[model samples]
Target: MTVADLVVDCLEAEGVEYVFGLPGEELEDLLFALEDSSVTFVPTRHEQGAAFMANVHGRLTGEAGVCLATLGPGATNLITGVADAQLDKAPLVAITGQGGRERLHKESHQRLDVVHAFEPLVKWNAQLSDPAATTETVRKAFKVAEHEKPGATHVEVPEDVAGEAVDGEPLADHGPVARPAPDDEALASAVETLEGAERPLVLAGNGAVRTNAASALRSFVDATGMPVVATYMGKGAISDRDERSLMTLDSGPESAAGGAVERADCVLAIGYDIAEHDPSGWNPGGEKTVVHVDAEPAEVYADYTPEVELLADPTAALDRLADSIDSQWDAWCVDAHETVYEHATRTPDPGDTVSVSNTLPILREAMADSDVLVSDVGSHKLAIAREFPTYEPGRCVISNGLASMGIAVPGGLAADLALEDDVVVATGDGGFLMNAAELETATRLGCSFTVVVYRDGEYGVVAEHQEQHRGESVGVRFDNPDLVAFAESFGVDATRAESLDEFGDAVDATESDELSLIEVVLSDPPDRRA
Candidate 1:
């Protein structure tokens, strides 16, 4: 059998159901092998979109999502999404096809050092130099990508090597092993600090949601009666509607949730990662006692030092901490809960402008509680993290680590396929156009999702920032095409909603199993401080 066949076998053994990429001549052999395998290959409009699809698939599944590309430009185009996955702690395996081995000593067409190019962005990467090592190499890539603090990995297969016959079997799938337990001394120290504190808080990060420990996290927070705040990517770690939740801490000390952080004497940082919310902004003084709980050790940062680093499974660590607490902070919890509730529940003044504060709750009501929502990087993403309530972890997908602008469309496509849930994407006009071509990819694949384009006819986030800092806007405005016609060109059902009533009507009319787009013409720009 060909090396490509064995590679496909390894992916099947890992339980991968799909591969996403655009085709190139270098990948011809692998493509043919995929056709015979059970894993479905999704051909995307662009390599960037394919990488994004793989990224969201990984984020939702906690397994390595696979994306393929040819050498040179194909490999380079996959960098952004792969880097996004890396920084966001999503498990992604990126495979690139290289030139023939014969050209190794000399410059050849479409040949570049792909392994080196990917090294800085991946957890681990290697060139598949020998056909004999195919299965083990593929196995190692998946294992590393799916390990604790999951991130992207890469495998480069040269054209000649892929075509060569190789006799090998996929490594045995032993299933995942149990995570290490927290040290007794560390756990005891954390509980002592937490118990001694007058006001304690929980800072949830992407790691909390990624590990599927939200329920355990909630139990800890509820049992201790502590306020909880999540980073932008960490939204939905506990349901936003939960009394202990303090909305999202996206703007650091300036956010409504930030008030809790300021008042917190001791912080239980559960599944926290510095990439999502750097400690320098909120913890400028570095004085608050912190208990770090996660699947991996804490990343070293000058301003962020944990008093006790509980390196263990987040769920188990939280479970232990909950049982060890001798007292509950009921008064602190009530005050903290009210502070966020006031910010979250405030109504916009009666006006023509459709506020995100109002729109997102309505949108949430229209979709199933289990349905997924993907947010593109823009002013809306900041608002969505605060306003949109996510009932479960992984239900709200945001690229906070890299905060890439065009992830929503392709990410929603992957979310639909990965979670088998109705997906809704929110994007500004500029962000929407960045990968809007992927609408055709979703249509071709029979994947259905709704796109809500916040049409302001400019780079809304940049413009808002410009206006805030300079007291005026420039160099960011652009005219948008007729969005309805643009979406309809891909055979998607499209409409325009001029008001909140009209927006709700349009959303309600859209079917879950059909491709649809609703262009919501914004009456005003988003708040910069929010």
Candidate 2:
């Protein structure tokens, strides 16, 4: 058997049915093996798109997202996405081809130490050398990525190694892990905290969204009349319309969440990994006791010290917490819910041009009630995060922890595939240009995303820092092309908006198989993230 055959067998064993990548000469052997394999390889326009789609695939399906690229530049291009998955703790497997083993130390043009470049960020990085170790190496990479505290793993395969002949059969299938159930003491301690507290709020994050905990959390929140506040990554786990649940806002200004949590007596943090969202603005420490629980122990008590850490499955923990505590809300949670309701409708100042405060509410009105949204990273991303109030599942996508650039358009493509309709992607002008060329790919696939370009005219997030922290702009600013012209070049529809009514009309005109690009002109003091 060939090493390439074993590689395909390993992927099949892991239940990975999707592979995203751009083919190159170095991957010829593996691509040949994958030609008619069980998994369907998605040929993306760029390695950045492949990485982004891989992340989306893994996120929505709860499987490790897989992608491949050639050695050197091909592998280098996926760094933005790879680093994103690493920071967000996403389980993604990225493979890159390399020059032959004999040329390892020589400067064979495209040769570089790719493994070392990714080592600092990844949970583990390895270069597959021996044909004998192929199966075991593949198996271990998948397991480490899927196990507790999941993150990205990089595996490099030299051309010689992949093309070599191997005598043995492919490795056996790996099975589900036997995760330890919640211990009696831990469950008891969690219940005691919930039972004794007069006003408790359940804060759910990515962990709850990724598991069966959403329904379980809703059940507990409803039974106990506790208010629910989900993180950006945990959006939609709790229904937005539910009275006991706070609307989902994973990333944004921390003021509201910080204020709310400060007033609560007990905070039950389920799957609340601080990694997915920054804790810079929100302070969890206070007189209130926090009960932190997740499948990953390291993510526990990250933002604030947990009064109790229940190392158990999120769904099981919430289910047990529900059964352990009795229903009681003495108007405190109700008052806190009322406070959030008041802020949900608040908008940016009338004179505020650059603030996201005003832009968000305006965009929300333009959004189709069911339209899917994706965000690209920047200060603008943070602004949109706070501004848009998403109350449902599968409506939004972003690199919560990874914060990868060039993801907006690609993620929008994936969202279109998932929902089979036009999607709306909000990004800064700089990020849009990063992979705006992929608009052609989206057009070819007959999928579209309403490209809401926040034209701050530069990397405004970095620019914002330079102006605020350094008192001037340094490495930001660009004269971008006309959006209408760019989209027309791809045979896709486009429009530019400078006014409120124009923005709404632009969005209303978007339809299936028709790509729309709506570029919002920036203000000198754009408070886009208000």
Candidate 3:
């Protein structure tokens, strides 16, 4: 059997069902071997897109999301996505092609220090030195990627190794992961704090979202009678339409998600990863304490040490906590939430076209059931992250902790592939430009997702900040370019969001087969986020 065959065999044994990636000459043999296995290779336009799609697949499937990139450019292109998964603690296995050992330090076009480049962003990085070690490499990479504080893992396959023949017998199937359950002592202590607290709040994050812990989260929230405030990645964890939940306010010196962390007497951060939230967001107020239950123990004090930290299955922890705690806080929180919502709904500085105040309501209306929303990073993304309500699971996706732009288009494409339903991507112009080339990706794959460009013609966040504190804009303004033509290049449809009526029609038409772009010019004066 060839070394590439062993690699595929190891992956299949590990039960990896899918890999999202772009191919390069160096990894072609491995790809060919995968053709016979149940493992499916999904093609993506850019390595970054493949990485993001893999990240999402991991989050959704509770397994490692695998992505492959070739040497040099292929590996480098996936850095943004690898960094994102690391920050949010998602399990990602990124396989890349590397130059042969004989060619190391020699002239190679698609070669760089792949290991060093990815070291900062990944939990583990290795370029297979021993072909015999491929099986073990795959095994360890999977474990570490899914280990406490999960992140990306990289294994660089040298070109020569790919073409070599394997001497060892085919590797055995991988065994199951061994995760430590919550210690009885910690569970007892966590229960004690929960049962006695006057008012409790459940703060959820990407980890919670990935663990299928929403029901557990709901049970805990119901038991405590408290409100749920999600981080960006945790948006749909509690089905925002439910009054028991509160929106993740992204503005004000502190947000509602942050306030929820502070206002409660006890904070039960179920599967919450502090990295997904601003540092200030996790600081509880005087006398208030956090009981952090997560899959990773080391993450316990990485930001702020919780009074009780339990490394256990998120859903399992929640069930145990719910059984031990009971309160009437939810009813009271409902009232508090209504007031918060009213104050929050107020309009912000008018933009070139519509006021930021009007943006949320209109968007909320536009993206209803059957519409998938993709939010970019920065002010516009922050607004959507704060205001838009996600009623269903997986209906909305965002680069919460990473806060990268250009993620929406690729992410939207993946969502389109996975979910054939209507998809809408909300992006700041700068951010959209990151993966705008994916318009061809979406078109070629016949992936239909509507793209909405919240065009401020300026870096709205930095501009507003400069205007507020510095009285001048620097490194923020851009000579507005025609976005329609950009989409047209992909042979997709395009239009501008003029009056409210025209904008409504455009959004109504977003679901059509032709990928559509609705450019909403932020011509109005910029304002600070609430």
Best candidate per TM-score, number?
A: 1
RMSD of each: 2.5, 3.6, 3.8
**Worst-scoring 10-residue span by lDDT in model 2:** 248-257
Question: TM-scores of all models?
Answer: 0.96, 0.88, 0.88
Lowest summed lDDT across 10 adjacent residues in model 1 is found at 343-352
Q: Any runs in candidate 3 off by more than 4 Å, and if so which?
A: 9-23, 31-45, 105-110, 167-178, 249-262, 282-287, 298-303, 340-357, 366-371, 512-514, 526-530
Candidate 2 C-alpha lDDT tens digits along 325-385: 7767634545444555455555545455644455677666656656677888887777655
lDDT of 1 at 121: 97
Off by over 4 Å in 1: 250-254, 342-352, 524-530
- Local accuracy of candidate 3 as per-residue lDDT tens digits, 359-424: 666666766665678777768777777767776655667776677666788777766766557778
lDDT (tens digit, per residue) of candidate 1 on 1-530: 99999999999989999999989999999999999999999999889998999999999999899999999999999999999999999999999999998996688897899999999999999999999999889989999998888999999999999999989889986876678887899999998999999988889899899988899998987788888888877888887777778867742224656777788898888888898888987688678899899887788887788899899999999999889998998656555556666555554344536855567756877878789999999878878887676778888899989888899999999998987788999998888998999999999988889999998777777787788788877777778899999999999999998888888789899999998999998885543332
State the lDDT at 148 in candidate 2: 60
lDDT of 3 at 132: 82
